[model samples]
Target: MAGRLRCPNCAAPLRLAGRVLRCAGGHAFDVARQGYVALAPPRRRLAPGDSPEMVAARETFLAGGHYRAIAEAITEATPAELIPSAGGAPLALDLGAGTGYYLAALLDDRSGWQGIALDASRPALRRAVRAHPQIAAVACDVWQELPVQDACADLLLNAFAPRNGPEIARVLAPSGALVVVTPTQSHLREIVDALGLLDVDADKQGRLHAALAPRLQSERRRELEFTMTLDHEQLRALIAMGPSAHHLQPRQVAERLARLPQRMRVGASLLIETFRRSGAAGASA
Candidate 1:
């Protein structure tokens, strides 16, 4: 876990000792029995991320393979996966790696690489730690400085989560690449009206570019759209696993879901993109 991670307090390299990760400056964090280390600064008490229910819902929904295509696209767009024989075994970092589903895919194609799954949610990291044997899970706020070393990660991944552009560019290896997955408004179109879901940001793509700026260069972008026929329980899990779960009451969820058919078809759309450090040779537009 300390392979590419730095101490949250001192930003020094961390070394594992017994059940704790410690920096040369004496800052120490105990690794939980659940196999994840929480790296958030203790004083700030950053707000909790995905709740237990949300994590469970996501685990269930993803295990259903509804978004398998999206995961595959993320892995395919990653440049590092193709060069598994790179000098040192490459490292892949997943920002807001939820349950490690996408990271798992990337690792599947790259035999020798290891993955670091970063998420604010302990519940998500817990699942991530268990999702794959080669994955190391860390709990850290995405908006805060990531507890990772500079220019260490060979690949970075972001899926349906926040992106910290500067932190991302700083952590990526000079020759590394980044893959991001964001949903288009067309995603779950049928459920949007029925479930009172939040509207997908209209300027999401424009804002993404602005945030990364000259620090990162865009390489490729593609939209993969698909359909799913979800049953009653599947529909409920789909809504519960998203941001809507925070605002929707149980009664409201039940009431809205009650009106929808037992099984309904919905479109799934994701904008997948790949980027490289701006100064990298042949960095794309």
Candidate 2:
């Protein structure tokens, strides 16, 4: 854990001193030996976020370029029209940002875009801040009100994380764009079947629209599909990026993985949907 942890309770700047992150306001949070802090309130303990291992897996899997297409899609869908007149860099939020890979990709060439990388997992936040200096890694959950001020974000990017449409709406600047990237139904289909995981349903898009219809207007949607070849080590990395890594027994995964081809052709699919936050007349009650 970094010494300079911000106090979640009092919004005070904190510094690491031995075992705890302490603020002048006297709020102290213990740093777990495994390198994460519990920032959630008691009632929010059950909120589902990535575990430390899951974060590691995502970091490794994304580092391999298997997900480059998603990154490219994000760049292509950026709201270029909103960049000017803002007078400063665009404010982008990577909700559930893991290791800051995607956010870092978006921040690469463009100057002046301040990124807030929010995640419940402190390890992920730590990795994010270290990986991307431009990002301010905040430890928080997405389901609750975002810690940011209302109408401040120029764009919100939710990739492979749960969505809170109303919460997202409140945080977006009027005309702010909401870009969501989700796996398509057939995404990693071969691997899902081979590994005995549940398949993404055909109704995923319909449900997405149903959830956001009243509060958002979909501007555009694009689907990307590609194939990548992975060795055994890469296969292990990919498995780690999923829930089965935590849910399934190690023996089961190992046994299944052992039977896979040394370098297999894996299909990947993703949908990039951009929406404008409905405000005033378009606001959801």
For lDDT, the strongest prediction is 1
lDDT of candidate 1 over 184-232, digit per residue (tens)? 8888888997788988998998889888888998988998999999998
Can you tell me which runs of candidate 2 are displaced by over 4 Å?
1-48, 83-88, 279-285
The sequence of per-residue lDDT tens digits that candidate 2 reaches over residues 1-285 is 232234556655667788776778887767565444555443555355677887888888888888988988997887776642145667888878878888888877457777878788776877887776677766677786665556667778888887777777776777678889988878888888888865777887888787777778787789889999888788777877776676677678889888888888889899998888655322233
TM accuracy, model 1 = 0.96
TM-score of each: 0.96, 0.82
Residue 222 lDDT (model 1): 93
The lDDT values for all models are: 0.87, 0.74
* Model 1: CA > 4 A from native: 80-87
TM-score of candidate 2 to 2 decimals: 0.82
Report the number of backbone clashes for model 1.
0
